[model samples]
Target: MTLLRHTSKEIKDRSALTINPAKTCQPVGAMYAALGIHGCLPHSHGSQGCCAYHRTMLTRHYKEPVYAGTSSFTEGASVFGGQANLLQAFQNIFEIYDPEVVAVHSTCLSETIGDDMPQIADKAVKEGKVPEGKVVVTASTPSYVGSHVTGFANMVQGMVKGLATKKDKKNGKINVIPGFVEPSDMGEIKRLCKLMDVPIILFPDTDGVLNGPLTGKHKMFPDGGVTVEELRDTANSMGTLALGEWGSSLAAKYLDSTHKVPCQILGLPLGLTATDSFIDALRKMAGKSVPAEISFERGQLVDVMKDYHQYLYRRKVALAGDPDQLIALTEFLVSLDMIPAHIVTGTPGKKFEERIREITKDVPYKVNVKVEGDMFMLHQWIKNDPVDLLIGNTYMKYIARDEDIPLVRHGLPILDRVGHQYFPTVGYKGGLRLLEKILDAILTRKDRDDPETSFELAL
Candidate 1:
């Protein structure tokens, strides 16, 4: 099936509108990145509603308590400035929450008003508002310019700038930035590193925080996230491995320039080739041979791919999500001989289309890829040209139902499903799980559509 059957090959100019965007605003991404740090309170230097929205979405997605502080801006603050409200917020946050660090992220309103965060932080220090050893970091995340991924990148870079130090010699510890994946994905990445005997420092880690077990008490600063001390030690690390160039490499680049930590940017390892590249990189970084356990995992994934080729081969699919995810996912689908007929993402990037085209240049059929595109446009394309499968966030379910097509939930804000918060989709093990889900969706459709006489005992 093809989703853009009626639409012409020639592209048209579009301006002044965006509908059902695949990406979200910046502050939410910054908040998620902040939660990866231990004992750190995320401070929103914007309206109370912005903070509430971010917290609510994160809580819904992760099914855990999401905590953040707001400056509680009013019309007065919006007009003149938010410096006063922020100063008060710092004092109250320290006195009430008492977190060891406060990560401040700016909003569109604050950025538009030109509030200097460093100046206000300095004032708070001079006025004795901040504790003696408490750390305060700021990230300029204006919501208007970029998507949530951009905000996440900005805050991560802020952490490197605000916390990392160079007091000791090179400690030979590798820095691994896992990108804006799930808490479960982060855990799996750490497990893989441990298996390779590689000592790594993973920042913005949210394993225990977002996926914490119920302990009969709610802790504002959950015992998850990167510790302040660990972040300070990142400067002494041997090198950096940044997964997903767009979402996870910004901080690595900053560290490389400022602290002399060599950085390697790689795609999120979602398929066989990508995962092999990731493992190879890890082996080189650790200066160790590939472990038997890791090799066995990779073999298992390949075995599943061979077994499921009958169902996946030649199946048409449409995918939408963040940039890096879409890139790796596209590679995975292509590896299965599945045609990614139509691809779309709300994040604005000139290189996204180019990279995707480069990967699909040899495919048999025409592959449509769009950057800064919305789901509405995708839906319209699907209306004109339908696909056998639709893979994306929960919002894509509506289109699936209307089009009578099978849908596979694959990206963020999966509001209506489970397992995403627990299972990973990065390493070889994750690849098997993703394959299972895709086969389940496609085979279920086949069983439902095939006639009773045509149905066989074996799949």
Candidate 2:
């Protein structure tokens, strides 16, 4: 047998670019995140394929029917203009979907030709298309410029900037920016805020909409999300809490700058430290003590950590996904004594560098971090220096398979896995979720590698 050694010299330049992008297209992530809002219809201002693909991916991931529309851009629309198609789409969607709020986000093709989305939105309103209380919002997301994380930020900002209104302040009301988290994560945030007796508003809230129960009747529109009333009143909130570093920055900054809404930025409520910090921020802002019920949750989370300590200790992991998710998950992995050897995110932004450094300062191994790119280079990095495991979405499965490292599926566009959409990845429950997957991956790898003679029934 020939010796096999991984080398940078053999790491092709195309790999330097992107062999397989870890993040989905900008428009899709924006649409997916938007669909979490209640009574909101997310429309793609590009080819029908873009909208269809996005809805399909979300439907599979959430195991629920996702509602969205396309401008139905054809060759003529591409060359001449998409303004007509978009206006028609707006008309048709309102007639059919009839959502209380319409959110329009653009793709690279539309953004490239310099399609002015906000202008088109204004024109649509001029024609008496959109209703008074039922508002319209738009986000410009050129796929070539940034990753899904950027798209999410753009969409969320559109919601706040376009919809938020200046009004009298609400003493108890708060804004919660959970960042590009799963539907279950959204649910947990709301639950925790309720327990703390803090009135909170989560923009693009997807918990009820995405993870809705399979009632005998299937409604095209799901019921869970931050209502239009909430969005309108969010400007009056006493404070805003952004969950992750990147996801929450735009909403926080926009509210603070535009409406003078006070904002607090924190890490995603993933691991213990991050979650505790998030809770403390909320408690102080609400002027309420951490309730005994939540204290019990912290204790339970610690108990789970202790129970799973042996399985997780020093389990080297490589992660690649959206930037905010990568940073949050990296910190969580390190919390479990797991070495995050390689990290990558497709979202392009300067913010990721600072966030990664701040979180990984205590990491035993300095993780190779990349932001605003694809997974192609990430796979190359893993091939060069193999890790014990991989923690990312379905796109990285081949890398794990080739390297013989068991992979745990997480993050957006999880095509190969299900149930995560309804399963909270925040709070104490999220720790249990992480522990279950980590142990299974490690044990499965051992089962595959152990010799028959030496392999025991149980480790």
Across residues 326-411, which tens digit of lDDT does each residue of candidate 1 receive? 99999999988999989999888899999899888878889888899988788777776789999999888877887898999988
* CA shift of 238, model 2, Å: 0.6
- For every candidate in turn, the CA RMSD to the true structure comes to 2.8, 2.9
Model 1 collision count: 2
Worst 10 residues of 1 by lDDT: 2-11
User: Model 2, range 238-352, lDDT digits (tens) per residue?
Assistant: 9899877667789788998888889998888887777888899999988989999999988887887787788788878888887767776787887888888878777667778
In model 1, residue pairs whose N, Cα or C atoms come closer than 3 Å (at least 3 residues apart or on different chains), thus clashing, are: 3-385, 36-225
Q: How far is candidate 1 from the true structure (C-alpha RMSD, Å)?
A: 2.8
Give the C-alpha lDDT of model 1: 0.89
Misplaced by over 4 Å in model 2 are 1-9, 13-16, 447-459
TM-score to true structure, per model: 0.96, 0.92
Candidate lDDT values, in order: 0.89, 0.81
User: In model 2, which residue pairs have backbone atoms overlapping below 3 Å?
Assistant: 19-376, 36-206, 347-372, 348-372
